[model samples]
Target: MPSVEILSRIQFAFTIAFHYIYPPLSIGLGLCLVIMEGMYLRTGIKMYEDITRFWIKIFALIFGIGVATGIVMEFEFGTNWAVYSRYVGDIFGSALAAEGIFAFALESGFLGILLFGWNRVSKGVHFFSTIMVAMGSIFSALWIVIANSWQQTPTGYIIEGEGLEARAIITDFWEMVFNPSSVDRFSHVIIGSFLAGSFLVMSVAAWYIVKKRFVEPAKAMFKVGLCVATVAALAQLFTGHRSAHYVSEYQPAKLAAMEGHYDSSAVAAMYIVGWVDAKSGKTTGIKIPGGLSFLTHGSFNAPVTGLNAFPGTERPSAVNFVFQTYHIMISIGMFLIALTLTACFLLWKKKLFSQKWLMTIFIWAVLLPQIANQAGWYAAEVGRQPWVVYGLLRTSDALSKEVKAEQVVFSLVLFSLVYTLLLVLFLYLLNKKIVHGPEMTPNEEDDSDEFSKRNIKQLQA
Candidate 1:
């Protein structure tokens, strides 16, 4: 039997993966701009001013793509998931509208000032614009998270009617905003963005060092990346822990699936790495005793529900895989934190530049966190299986009734091809910009000439 559920999932996954490529960058870069502008204001550093300008150009490009792709996802909710939209429309519409009115407007209005008003605006005004841009990103995340959290821990909504005609209405806006799962998820997402941004900074800095270009500017960027990555990574651990606890409490079925538990137990073992046997309802390869219990309940022997407790229709089939993937993502995130902090320490000891291996590792480290972010998102969304609106609406019921599988399949293929082309173009242009480097100041060029002469003499000796 061909299932529309499969098509719905495929379309949703494609759109989300494409749209997601940009938001973390925007969120992280927004914060980076704030830090850069603040440094310029505090120290009167001309280099900080120049670096901000350089990064702002890249930010503008990425931000535009993010906005465009994000719009598609919104439309997709109505187009492909019409039933889902109708079911939770009242609740989601308000949050999205607020995002546009409160966050998008502020971001667009001030982004121009941040990017192009350097000469037109006063220093204080410029700094204020940067702050506003950062706030705008945060504000945007707030509303979006509100809508998503509603799915995870539905509140402030009352269902009316029956079966296919049932619809959810917003009864309380504040309650929706402050839903039990909202804060933890929002915090975790924002921190993940910060981690992404910090890694971007470090990766670029590593590239600069490898090429022996813009040493001072690169060092400054590295320092900012180090601080951000360190703090965000640590914060992610805490927030993720909190989010996991919330999931265990509010969505225990998901927790059980994530850990591949088949029977309820006082102490459940977590799989650090393994494959799940769906037929047998068990995990294989490896396991960590009581780790799942400790993670969810903060105790070694706390009772945790298992998949067997839930009906067949209620269980997510890939629970163990999702759980293991999530654990791997977190492990990579922790490693990034440690790596960035260690690089910072080495830099402090004047040894970072001398260690090509560490710098090489740092150059590629950003990829790990990016993958982790995507995997984390996949786990969160997919592990909530069978239901699109938690207990309120099943995903199969929420798919568009009129939309044919072939129509969706065609669009999916087209979108994939177009996005792949755009991705290639983006990477090429980005590489070109990085290779060109920033426009050099006159004094910087003079200093570079002298430094080159000294280097040549040392090489001759």
Candidate 2:
């Protein structure tokens, strides 16, 4: 049987991975909703308002599940990682309090208006509510990232006790919030959420176009999604590069593992796709010679600290796993950029929706951004393994002393069952919504008919 620590870790990973699916959707959909509502306010287009209304229902569904699943992690902290919780409580307390005050409050307060105030509130008030909800989601991400980043590169805190009694005491609240990895990681995560949300819109829109149902609104949604995906994909490249630079400077072992570098003195070659044989301390595949060096140091000859420089115990043991996941994320990012730009070109030539191949691709392409987001998250979290809180705390030592492996196993099974049911329910409702499509009044239907007639030629071509 696995130890309690192993079981607890697996349980947390399972729950968090499942829970993570919704937040990005929430954040991304929030942004998309804001855009759609803003367009409604600007142009007096009822279709945009209808589109906004449809997605708001989906967004609320995502937000509800996200909140429900997220609450599990908080409890797990106390039940499975009691020691770790005690250690980080002082630091996390302030951050969580801030999240409640600045993020959740704003988000939840306007949420009612955004959801049920359609006829009750003025159009301007409704739009304002949408904007506030989107901003609230962004703020929520900010505090969560700040807390996680502090774990990655802990600072502005000092150890106050010894051994099991030890805890991190916050020295400067601002410094802890603005830790070295916070901004870069925050931007990366937020952009990733945007990509996930936009692609979802695109996927559904593309499906509608292919089926010739609600083609007008689908085209509008597809255009908006394509626009956001393009910008986010481009920005991701810069943010990812910046993130790598920071990891190189502050977390050399993890950077080395990510690139599959082993030699202490040799210039690190960046693998395009490779296999790392940990036993042989070698990575082999097609690579750009000194590519890692050039990217990290601005020169081909610059030396990057390698895994060999760190003790075996200190290095990420799953070198190849990290390498593969990191590459997967990079590969997906490039693919999104290419896909979006191609769609944009076709759109510019007025040939976007008519292209059955492109529309079909977009129909299924929603999974790509989600896959990339999960891969990136796994790479970051797993690469930092062995250490629960970087240099300050080891994961092995963080588990609750009273917890047993059997208890953890039981809870894991229970969680798996419950989460599976949640997944099924979520899918059933989502499919129902997509199949029903956008709602339209009699006048709006006439307008859509006229709009379709104007664009029927494009569909034919």
Candidate 3:
């Protein structure tokens, strides 16, 4: 029973949250494809080829859904956020156009060859196609993150005129692309995508192992997935630290809310586990005094700005939302790091495949990255509340004037129904694919022994 504006905002959030699920999957899967296909070429291993082919089906399915959902979001900008769109039209046009030219074209051009060209082209040619598709996915993330980070930081833009008629013009394209928050956020997103992809691959492989089906290829997938997960999880720690530093420097209000810093402090404490009492505007948790100071400023007693620096109206609208979601993301990230690193150690010890309990945990571990990704996104978007374009424009002023309450309500209901159906369809298709597993070519089956022979020492177990 919110007002029209609030309903519209909630509607958009719901649709976009649903849509956000696919891109990371596709992006992560793309990198896995590259790794698998590249290994096949280098080792001429049918096991690698099997992993590559099976995941291509998954990759294609995810990519299709991502494209579909992304299109819906684009239309929404014009429909629900018309005024905001006009204000940043030039900036969006440039970035989106670049995405199409650099990302979509490459992905689409090579995707067909990657998907359907196994029998038609040379192995080298097919591998090249996979490379392009992987690069394209990363490129897509780059431009999109750059655009979003611009909103968070409002860099390299100059506003002309005043009020409803004002527009922000890009002063320097490169500056805009590398805004204060862009590269840091971009790193976090890219690493998160890799983790997502790795976890998916790991989950399926783990399930196959537990079921005692597709043993060899599953081993191959699990090994490669472990590699990606371990490396990406470690990288995320670095990227996360840098991202937090940037947020602390440039978005103190958001940082304050994220850490639940209510009072001004020369040395800020980081909450390891915490919750906020929204009614009383008080934070409660066990925290390490000055832990945040060390993490963000490289000193235990460094001055860290707090929420009191911002006025009540300018503060984040949902402090609990930011606090809880950020902590969830951080906790999950640490868990992933520990999980992957443990798997890595066991793999080195050649005891990984025998660990049934661990495999069982990994079988359902795909959901962790999904949760972490959503939590991270929630922390980011909610922390930036009130501002649609940082300080340039408040979210209330960005709504389209022509859209009616009833129209938004109707659209929200319809979209919810359609999206629910779509979710069911997607899950059905994905389950069907997982249950069916990979189809090995006749040649791969014939060459299974040779392929298995080429699998390095670790996979020999």
TM-score of each: 0.95, 0.97, 0.96
The digit string of per-residue lDDT tens for model 2 on 1-461 reads 99998899889989998988998988988889989988878777677888999999999999999999999999999999999999999999989999999999999999999999999999999999999999999999899989999989999998998999999999999999999999999999999999999999999999999998887889989988988999999999999999998899889999999999998867889988999999999999989999999999999999989999989888788899999999999999999999999999999999989999999999898999888988898899889987889988988999999999999999999999999999999999999999998886445455434454433444334
C-alpha local distance difference test of each model: 0.82, 0.91, 0.87
Backbone collisions counted per model = 0, 0, 0
lDDT by residue (1-461, candidate 3, tens digit) is 56666887888889888987898998888888888888878777667787798999989999988887777788889898888998998898999999999998999999999989988999989989999999999999999998999999988888987888888899999888889999999999999999999999999999988888877788889988888898999999999999998898878899999998877666888998998875676788999999998998889989888887788878797899899999999999999999998898898898999999999999889999989999998899889988889888888888898888888999999999999988999999999999998886554443433333434443454
Which candidate, 1 or 2, has the higher lDDT? 2
Worst 10 residues of 2 by lDDT: 452-461
* Candidate 3 segments exceeding 4 Å error: 443-461
Q: Give every collision pair in model 2.
A: none
Give the alpha carbon lDDT tens digit for every residue of 97-182 in model 1. Answer: 99999999999999999888988999999899988988998899889988999999998878997877789988888998899999
Give the distance in Å from residue 341's predicted Cα in candidate 1 to where it truly belongs: 2.6
User: Can you tell me which runs of candidate 1 are displaced by over 4 Å?
Assistant: 447-461
Q: Residue 81 deviation, candidate 3, in Å?
A: 0.9
